[model samples]
Target: MRKYLFIFKAELMSALQYVANILLHMITYFIVIIIFFYLWNYIYDDPTQLINGYSKTQMIWYVIITEIIWNIVSGRKLCRRICDDVKSGNIAYNMNKPYNYIGYILSSHLGEGIIKSLIYITFGIILGRVFLGAFPTLNVLSIVLVILSLILAVVIDTLFIIFIGLFSLYIEDANPLFWLYSKLILILGTMFPIEFFPEVIQKITTVSPIYVICYGPAKLFVDFNLNNALNIIAFQFIYLAVAFGLCGVLYAKGVKKLNVNGG
Candidate 1:
């Protein structure tokens, strides 16, 4: 724990040095939310009309929250990093180190994302309030629940990224798989709420990362439902276990297959 804590702090400080990168990302974030704001507005000429059980305000806020989460917890970068590690022989070298390689990667990714999460979520809320008005009513418990769901969403998203990235051991590249996963989340959840989809797609999304990763936190933030929050968090834990186990199995097998430097 202490060793990984050091790695976490080291990565956090390294990420802090890249302030310009954060600024550039925020610029894109601004453009994205603005685009969606207008698109949704045009879709709902009558702001009061409910499309698939979401009011205009609810729908707009849903997009905002989900986009924020998606950007902060980007799985593509994690997948790429893992692939690079494998290709560059870093994964093999790290295996000889005292620390667990997967733990190191996980800690580093979370640490880097912490600052971005703050900046994005802060600016995201400001943007939402400015353009769409205040968020839906919520008490202290609801706020705590939303925050918890968001954290769960991040961890689960990261685990899935690690799971896909582990395929780097057997495949030439795992990034294409990540591409598919990210695009699914983007079209199915980030750009629009799940309710916007047809009934069949909606049912299918529940099993995919779209439900626990994107829609869960956004839905709770927009419309706090205790039962739904509990259910989402529950599913998140299940995915968490599945992803973690897969990563562990693949990492163990990969290590056994390592032939680094005439080992």
Candidate 2:
């Protein structure tokens, strides 16, 4: 456990060294918030109001929370790191290490994720205050649910990324696969809420883990309803279990096929 924590700390420190890059990434998302705000405002401009079930203020706040969760769930470099390590023969070194490789990778990611989430949430709240007049309501129960959902989002997202990373053992080129996965996230409502989707598409997205990561927490933070919030929490855990089971099978098989060039 200590060894893994050390690795996590190392990764976090390395990330901190690229202070400019981190600031740029955070600012890029702030731009995204502005883009969505304008886009949605135009769509909802009519006096009759095309969108129902949420006011403009609520919708903007929804986007803000989704962006915060996204900062944690997205931007993982696990798959790319795995591919690089495998290609460079560094995976051989990892195999001989005392720590479990998957645990080490996960811990490293968790550390970076914690830092990114804090930065994004702070910027997101400030952006909301200035641009959208958004503010979080104070409630202990709601805050607890938001935290729980955020943790589940990270776990489920990491499991999914690990599953994708395992493809490196089978596929000759993992870049194309990574590209496709990224595109899917954008189209499938990771950046924007799925309420923008058609009814049928919205129904489909509701079952996907990505929706749980972004939309579930966004809704809970804004509305703070107990019943639906609890339901989303339950679904997140179940999705996480399925993700872990799938990744376990893939990891077991991928290790057998791993090819290590010169030590």
Q: CA RMSD for every model? A: 1.7, 2.4
Model 1: CA > 4 A from native: 261-263
Model 2 steric clash pairs: none
How much RMSD separates candidate 2 from the native structure?
2.4
Error of 1 at 17 (Å): 1.4
Which residue segments of model 2 deviate by more than 4 Å?
46-50, 74-76, 136-138
For model 2, what is the alpha-carbon lDDT of residue 254? Answer: 80
lDDT of 2 by residue, 14-98 (tens): 7777757767888778888889888778877753453646667777788787767656656446678877776777877887889
Q: Report every candidate's CA lDDT.
A: 0.86, 0.76
Tens-digit lDDT track for model 1 on 207-244? Answer: 88788889999999988888998898899888888878
lDDT for model 1, on a 0 to 1 scale? Answer: 0.86
**lDDT of residue 237 for candidate 2:** 86
| Model 1: colliding residue pairs | none
